[model samples]
Target: MKLQKLIILFFFILIGFAGISQNIMEPKDLIPANDEIVNWQLIDSVNTYTDEDLYMYINGGADLYLEYGFNKLGSCKYRNRLASKIILEVYQMKNDAGAFGVFTINSSGKGKKIEIGNEAVQYDYYLHFWKQNYYVRCASTVKSEGVIDTLQQLAKQVASKIELPGKKPELFVLFNKTGYPFKQVKYFKGQVALANIFNFSHGSVAGFNEGISGKLDDKMVFVFSYENEKQRREWFASLKGKMNMSMLFDQYTTVEDGFTVKDRMGIMLSFKPVGKYILAIKGMDWPEAQPVFEKTSTNLP
Candidate 1:
C-alpha cells in the first residue's frame, strides 16, 4: 500500500508541473474547427508567417507590422454549404501593447465597436480585435446578411479561445485624465506610423521610443515618450535645431523648458518637455495652449 501511494503522489506532482509549464495557445488553435460552428468548415490547413517572411505575405503593409513587434501569423479559410467563405488571420505580437497598437492603426475609428474581445470593431463583412498578445481579423469576400452573421460568429469563437485579458496602454489613461479625451487615437512605435499621421521631418523628434497622436477639437495633439529624461532632453535639443533649419516652421523660439514654432500654414504649435515626455499642441494660440500644457504637466507622473 505504501509503494502504491508514493507512485500516485509522484504522478500528481508531474501533472501539476506539466500544467504550470504549458505554453500559450498557438494562433491556429484559436480558430473554430469543422462543425465547431454549425455550418462552417475549415477549408485547409492554417498557413503561418514569421518576422522573416511576413513581407512575402503582406508585401506593402508588412513594414507597419514589423515596426509594432510582430511575431508570427496563422491564416486559413472557412467555407459554408452555399460556398460562402471567410478568411481568418490571427497575428501573435510581442506583447499586449503591440497587439493594441496594431488594432488601433488598422481600425477606421468609425466602425461599430463591439465587445467580442478586449476591444473590437465590426463592419459589414469584416471584423478585427485585440486581446492579450493576439490580433485577429475576420473578412468575407462578399457582403450578405448570412455572411455578415457568420463573420461575427467566427470572431466571437476566436475571441473566446483567447483566455487572457489586456488593457489599453498606460499613456492612454494619462491622456484621458489630462482632459484630452480623444475618441480615436493612434499609438505609434516609430517614425513609420508617426509619418502616417502627419509628416514631421524624418530626423526631427521622430526618434521617440513610443508616441501617440490624435485630433481633438480641430487641433492635433501629439505626445512623445523617451526611454529616460536624459534621452528626452537630448532629443528635444535636436528637435529645436532641426525645426530652425527646416522650412516647415517659420517662427522658432525657445521657451522655459521647451520651444514653440509656427508652420507655414500660420498655425502655432507649442511643445513642452516634462519628466520623460514631450507634449505638443498644434492649431492653438499661445494663450490657450499654455493652460492646456500646464494642466497636463501638473498631472504627469
Candidate 2:
C-alpha cells in the first residue's frame, strides 16, 4: 500500500510541474505596479481570458481570434485625474503573422502610423500595435496630449516586458510595392476572409492556401498562392474554361494566357498566371498592368 501511494504522489508532482511549465510563456510579467505610472491607477486588477472565453468581453468578435490562433488575452482598465478611463487589451496570438492578422482587422484603415512596438498605429482616441506575437489595443474616453502620452508610456512599458521573436511573415515581402504602400497591403490565410474581401473563384474553387493583396494607383492587385501547381492548374482551368461560356459582363478580351473583362457599367478586371500563383488586377489599364505583372512574376517562386 505504501509503494502504491508513493507512485501516486510522484505522478501528482509531475503533473504540477507540467502545469507550471505550460504557462511559462503567458504575459504574467505585464501587470503594472500600483505606482508604476504617475497619473494612472489600475481600475481593479489585471484580468485574463483565453480562446472561446473571450466571448464574454467581445460578444461577436471572439470567433475571429480563434480563427487566427489566439492563445490568451490580458486586459486592464485605467482611470486618470480627469475621471477619464482607458481600456487596454493585449492579445497574444500564435505568432507574428497571426498578430498582424488581428491588427489589420481592428485598425481604423486610416491612422498616423507610429513607432512604439514592432509596428504601431494611432487613432484620435486610442492606439493599436503589434510586436512579436502580441497585438495590443488602448481605447480611451477622452482625447488630449496627456491621454495619448500616458497610453504610449504604458504601451512601451508593456512592450518591453513581452518576450518573443520579432519576425514578420516571410510571404509579406513578396508583394510588389510599385504603387502599393504600407496601409494598402493585407495578408490572408483562409478562404472565408478572401471571399469576404474580393470574391473570385469563391471559398472553394480558388483552393487558396494563402494570399496577399495591395492597392495601386489605378487598380487593386490580388495575388493568390495555391497548394501546388496541380491545384493552381485545376483552379485556373476552371476559371479559363468559364471565360468563353460565362457571362458576368459583355466585354471579354483574352490576354496572353488569361482574360480581361468590362461590365455594362465599364468596370474592368484582368487575370494572369504567374509561376504557381495567380495575379488578378481589377480596374487596371491593360498596358500599365503588363510591367507590374512582369515585376511581380519575377519575384515569385
Candidate 3:
C-alpha cells in the first residue's frame, strides 16, 4: 500500500511539471549570439491560473485587464491589468528589409485607456512577432513611449532573416502659386486636397476642378462642356469678357480635354506679377521657347 501511494504522488507531480514546461525557461531560452541584434531581455515570468485576469495601470487612473490563456510577462509595464479571457492568439514575424529581429508579444484583448495631459495621451499596444520581425501596434488610446527604440533593436536581431522583394520608383510633385506659400501636400488617387494655413493674406486661389469645371478657392464659378471647335470658340469669346486680367491666362489655356504641354498659347496670360511662374514642362529636357509657341498653336489648349 505504501509503495502504491508513493507512485501515485510521483505521477501527479510529473503531470503538473509537464503542463507548465512550455512557459519554463532553460539555458537555450537566451537568444543566440547572432540574434543579439534584437536586444530582448527577459523581464519576469509567472504561472497564473488559466482564467486569472492581468491588470494594467494607464496614465489617467484607468484600469485595464487582459483575458488570459498562456501569457508571458516581460519588462514592459501596462497601465491596467490584462484579463485572461480575451487573448485569442500570439505569434512572431520577421522584417523583409534586414531591419529588425525576432521578438515575442501578445494579442486580442479588450483595449481601454484614459487621457493624460493635453500633449501626453494614453494608448494601448498590441504585440506581435513573426519569424524575423517584431511589431507592436497601437490598438487603443494610449501610445507606446519607446516604440522606435524597441523596433530598432528588433531589426538588428532579424537582419539576416529578412528577404526583401523588388521595388518600383515613382515621382510626385505639387504645383501651387496662389500668393500663399504652397504648403506641402500628399497625392492620393488622382485628386489634390488643399488645406488653409490660416494666414492673413486674402487674394483668392484658383485651380481646375474635375476636368470640365473651374473653382475659385472655396467657390464654384463656372462649368464648361464644349464638344466642338465652334462651341469652344463661342465659349472663349464669352469667357474673355467676364474674367479678370489675372484669370485670362487660365481661361486661354483651358480646353475641352484639359491643358496640354504642346499648347503654350496661354503662357503670355499666365505669367504672374513678380515674374515668378509655374511652368508644366513634359519631356526629358526643357524645350526652346520657339518650339513651345509653335506646339501651343497646333495643340487644342
Q: Compose the digit string of candidate 3's lDDT tens values, residues 122-232.
A: 224333332212122222223445543343343233222322221111111112222222222121111111112111012222221111111223321111223444644
Put down candidate 1 lDDT per residue, 137-232, tens digits, no spaces: 999988888777788888889888887777678876677787766757888898777777766656587668888777886788888989899999
> Can you list the residue pairs that collide in candidate 2?
none
Better of 2 and 3 by TM-score: 2
How well does candidate 1 score on lDDT at residue 145? 82
- Which is superior by TM-score, 1 or 2? 1
Candidate 1 residue runs with Cα over 4 Å from true position? 1-23, 80-84
lDDT of 3 at 106: 20
lDDT of each: 0.83, 0.74, 0.25
- Flag clash pairs in model 1: none
Give the top-scoring candidate (TM-score): 1
What's the TM-score of every candidate structure? 0.86, 0.78, 0.20
Per-candidate alpha-carbon RMSD to the true structure: 5.6, 7.1, 21.9
Count of backbone collisions within predicted model 1: 0
What's the candidate order when arranged by decreasing lDDT? 1, 2, 3
